[model samples]
Target: MNTRSTSRFSRAALPLGIAAVMTLSACGGGSSSGESSGSDTDTSAFSINLDDCEDPASATEPITDTFDIGYSAPLSGPVAGAVELATAGYDARLAAANEAGGIDGVMIEVNYKDDAFAPDKAKANGTEFIQNDGVDALATFGTGALSAMVDDQNAACVPMLYPSSSTADFADIEAFPWTTTILPLATNEAKFLVNLIQERYPDGVSVGVAENPTASGKVQGDAFQEVAKEMDLPIDAVVSDGDPVAAATELKAEGVEVVYHGGVTGTCAAFDSARGRIGYEPELVLKPSNCVNAVEYIAAGNAADGIELGAFGKDPNASENEGDEGVAMYKEQMDAAGVPAEIQGNAVAVSGWTQADLVVNTLEQAAASEEGLTRLGVMMAARDQDYASPMLINGIKWYSTPELLTGIDGFRPIKWVAADEEFVPAGEIISIRP
Candidate 1:
């Protein structure tokens, strides 16, 4: 069933560190499925009361056959180049899974759309997918757009699963139980960065963040600000987008030692190159995971050298993985699918593969559960997920709990090797310590 169509897709940072298990505010609200409608069962660790909102698709008929999943992303926008590579990785994994006989013999079907990264468009696409298409599960991109439509998703009682902006509101399980994130949450990234910096420069170090106006960027900068305050590291500057060169100049004048970055794609190379142009070599310069792409460095030129990015385990460049079994499977499948060599080996592409791993594993559990292929069943499997993701690095495993919703306990730090134009492990996995 090739049901592809057209369409679209807030996190505040939580307390710092992987050890800070969130005591969600939405705990014990009501029914996790629309089948029970208004039943307020406090038994499950995560739940959503259908009575709070309306969407008949929540009780979507049991899928004893093909399981339809809807996926949406910014297929037509400024970051479309990066988006394309990510999509390639996702599609490749789906192909391999389908070839392997799929979940419980039920093949997965995907309906696709290009949201252009806009909120209104994403909201419209989501409504169509949940209500009209009657898809059993959903996955999407665009943080601001998705955050605006949480009510619509939660009301339908469908599992809005997989990769997207890991916003604060989405992870508040008590409130949005149907939503599960695959990307690195800002809070986790903040904790890891702060810890790594402090661990390396014990005495102290002045830090600065290159900020942007996007929802993801705002939240990223906010998270860094929050963690820095808690750790007592003075921030030299919180420079916004539009003038990376001038921003670099300002940060240098402020005596900023690390030109760390926060924001979506393009921002990394921009700021890193800006510093390079003026020969302002801060002790260290790094980027958040979302911007971990070597091709983007073309604009940043030589400045991209020495830039490190926080990864959620998987490094896109296969060379860095060498003998990893999971990564080997990924490369074999991606190669068989004929995905472009460069695209198949990119960080964004592996992120897509990782998202597929989350969904495939969740579907397997749902098919075996008593609930069986229903929206709530998927949610249950995702909530209790305790497994390894094929694409992660440094033995990172995927897990979920009442405290951790994303299944990611820490961020794997990978650095760019400018000479080889690839990203490799720069240090040990800096875990989120209590």
Candidate 2:
């Protein structure tokens, strides 16, 4: 579900045919003053080399009245599930934003193409969105879909506002200045998870990691291992290749006291089911943020009861949260937008709504920046943000800087109670930054 929308409200605007261009003096993107963390007003933080940027003069000559957004992601493949759910959230947010009056009275439009999770197809789609469709910004769903095309986006100087993966690669604004992510950084999640375990079980618990074999999964799994080692925490076993049951059995045989499955929702669900089938209950089974789902885990099996999760936002689907501000906004907006009633019970769409809101907010901020509504201005505005809303837990602040690329530094710990079919807050929100 989503929140807040009207049917494209109109605002006063300037003459429409002038092309938007980037100048160091206009936006202060060429200077080097705000490299340090949390530089909220650092206009010079996002560097742009015109030569490296794709035909900014021709590709974006005479800015159009409508702000076009294009997405390249797997719409027809196995991995398309999450993207599809996120799309619903994105669409809901876009509709709501347009309803609330799009940036400067200019309407926002979005187009999506099926990349089937292929890097090559994703690259082609990204190029088409720029050279062909003249989209104001580009968005890609997964890491593989964006890997082959992000350089092109940066070369063209187009802002690829939040590519849904958290491999830490997007944090390198030096290489991909036009890219940013609303997703919690994999590195940050790993560090926080390790620290949480260490702080709770001071005597030390045997940790085992179930690493997902995919690129993004490997990145997250590797981060977990690295952080665990840095904290002098030893892993009892590591399993990457095996059936879910086999992996669970192996970890149990190792006498692992805790298991952290750094994978997507489905993988985490499988691991939980596998553990339960054999009655191999560890002290805790920590799953990454991606596993914050209502149906997936519970449907997998009742073993999901004790599964600990890292949450970047409040749970909209939890029944007890019916009166929460974010929850009400999501349910009402989604219902208003005619999204299925079932989606209100799933956190995936809520995650999508959060990401889309980030994009909407970024565009809104960029429109008001000193450089005006140029594409370069969008990147500059996005590079430094202090986003606060009822969408996140009360004390958690989602911000970004040239130095601190990770947007959400902390996550509130959550526990899934299959019996109640909801996520319960376990403890205080943990911030790894300090």
Q: List the lowest-lDDT window of 10 residues for candidate 2.
A: 28-37
Minimum summed lDDT over a 10-residue window in model 1 is located at 29-38
Top candidate by TM-score: 2
Off by over 4 Å in 1: 1-44, 53-57, 316-320
Which residue runs of candidate 2 sit more than 4 Å off their true CA positions?
Answer: 1-41, 58-62, 317-323
Q: Candidate 2 on 173-271: residue-level lDDT in tens?
A: 677777887678887888778888888899888889998776667777888898888879898899972378888889989999888898764345767
Inter-residue clash pairs, candidate 2: 2-334, 6-99, 53-155, 54-155, 54-156
Q: What's the distance in Å from true for residue 244, model 1?
A: 2.3
Q: Using Cα atoms with residue i matched to residue i, what is each candidate's TM-score against the true structure?
A: 0.86, 0.87
Mind giving the per-residue lDDT tens digits that candidate 1 earns over 1-434?
12344222111222223112222121111111101111122225554454444543344235655677777677778667777777788878877888888776677778877788887877887888877876777778757767756678887777788757856667888788788887777877887888778887998888888886678788888888898889887787888866878888888888888866886863457777788888888888767788877777766777777777677756645566678777778888899878877777677788877788777777776666655665656776677655666777655656566545655666767777777777777777655522
